[model samples]
Target: MLAGSAIVFGGVFGFVAFKNHMIKQFFATMPKPVVAVTIAKAGLTEWRAVVPAVGTLQAVNGVDISGAMSGLVKSIAFESGQDVRKGHVLVQLDTDVEMGDLRSAQAELALARTSYDRSATLLRSNTVSVAALEKAEAELKVRQAKVAGLQAQIAKKTIAAPFDGRLGVRKVDLGQYVQPGQMVANLQDLSLMLCDFSVSQKDLGLLGIGQAVRMTTDAWPGVVFEGTVAAIEPLVDAKTGMVSVQARFPNADGNLRPGMFARIEIERPSGAPVVTVPASAVAYNLHGDAVFVVREDAGPDGKTVSKAERAVVQLGERKDGMVVIRSGISPGDVVVTSGQVKLEHGSLVSVAASDPLKTAAAGAVR
Candidate 1:
């Protein structure tokens, strides 16, 4: 019985070994998994960098109109938010009182002139004392001064536009009493607009007068306005450690208004072109950014199996959706953009083509 049991065990062991050998042979005969690859080509590349900042838009010329003389508003010539030209009458104060005063002054001046004429005649005839003639002359001069003062006051009662601009909400209506120095309305020349913003001191050297800037505002959606740097503040803000900048844009249509918030992008120069790959392809490490490049080589079966070689790159300014590479790779070299999380130096790899270029273009438009 013991001998029969040993024979059965031997037979069973041999069968198991045969099945394992067959399975290995089948796997070896099967083909390797197929992977897609994107061919790399050399092309012209543009390098640009942009700095973003929040800013406020303002009219290049803005002013607050004020009442210069206290009186009742007889009429408001301009409607709220009306556009007016320079020298156009904007407000008329009740000038009846001023006219009456002017008339009285004119009457006194006429009487003084007649007295002065008579005094001069008397002095020429030597029929009156010199002191009497001098007294008449003094009274006539005083009346003339009063007449001039009254004329000046009458002119002030009629308020005119100081410049060509659009008016804000009216602060006073017809027949309303306005005190001297009271705000009547606001006026802004919207033909040109300015954007005021600030940037970090570290970037001060990159910014200068006449640099191009692209701007967008919440008030006007999806419209990109172009401007140029108008000025840079002479001094940096000590507390915030930022330098203020002003950019100007043409607003001939009066679309941009004062106090509108905007997003500003300032462009700066980028140095010579270097080898670059998709940002996603780069793996971060304590050392630096690294990418896996596919290397083509012949396998045991005389077919090509893609292999990966680790490459270290020095990165520079990033613009649009592309990063600038300073070194490590060259143009026309294929680098892995995805599926490289577990890859190591000199590891075997399979190339997979994805729509990464399309994705990057879409991001740039946004």
Candidate 2:
């Protein structure tokens, strides 16, 4: 009985060992897939970097119209928001007082001239003493100077436009008293406009005078305005580490106004061709960036299967959700845009007909 029991126990142990060995061999002999892959072709590529900034629009020539002499406004020749030309009469102040003063000065000047002439004649004829003639001449000169001063004051009462421009809201009305230096209205030469903005010091190398620029303002959506760089500041701001720049734009229609905020963009030439891939395809690590490429090889059954292989690549600029690849990959190479996290080097894979990557799914594959 003891011999029979030992035989049965030995047979049971052998059966268990055999089953475990077969299971191990079966797993080992499983075939790795030969992945289907697309080949890359050489082509031209462009790389560009953009700098964005917010700025304000201004007129090339803007000024505030003011009174030069204190007086009541007699007549206003311009309406609010009206256009005027250089030397055009804008305001006529109450000239009654000024005119009265001018007339008095003219009469005094005539009297002085007559007295000086009589003194000269009498002195020449020996009828008047030299000291009396000298006194008369000095008094006559004083009266002439006073007349000239009054005439100048009269001219100051009339205000004229300094340049061709549009007028702002009127600050004073007809018959309103305005003091000297008081702002009567704001005027801006909108025939040409200027856009002022600042950029980082690092980007200064890319900028130059006369470079083309594009701009947009919230007030006019979907409208693009073009301009050219007019000037670059000689000095940079130390605190912000930025340099100021101004761009000029023709505004013959007078649509653009001073102090309107704008968004600016500058165009630059592109450099050498760069490899680009969808941004979603890249896997980032502390060491470097990497992507999975689908590799393929023929199997014993003469059919192809897919496998994933990790490739390290260098990155450049990013635009439109696509990143420029500097090295380690070429254009048209099949890359794993999705399912990267679950993949390892030389891992077997099954590619579904549907695009697993959100980027590729949005558009047709190139």
Q: Name the best candidate (by TM-score).
A: 1
Q: What is the TM-score of each candidate against the true structure?
A: 0.73, 0.72
Question: Compared to the true structure, candidate 2 yields what TM-score?
Answer: 0.72
| Model 2 per-residue lDDT at 262 | 95
TM value for model 1: 0.73
**Candidate 2 local lDDT, 1-366, one digit each (tens):** 999999999999999999999999988997655343332222235656667778899999999989889999998888999989999888889889778888887888788889888989999899999998888889888888888888788788889888999898989888888999999889999999999999999889989999988888998999888889999999999999999999998887777889999998886577766666777778999998998877776656888866777899998777666777788876666777667777789876666543334334223323
Candidate 2, overall lDDT?
A: 0.80
What lDDT tens digits, residue by residue, belong to model 1 across residues 6-106? 99999999999999999999998976543444423222255567888999999988989987899999988888999999988989899898799889989
Q: What are the runs in model 2 whose C-alpha is more than 4 Å off?
A: 1-43, 48-52, 129-137, 278-314, 319-322, 335-366
Model 1: CA > 4 A from native: 1-44, 49-54, 127-138, 199-213, 220-222, 236-242, 283-287, 297-302, 308-310, 340-366
- RMSD, each candidate, Å? 6.0, 6.2
Model 1 lDDT at residue 335: 72
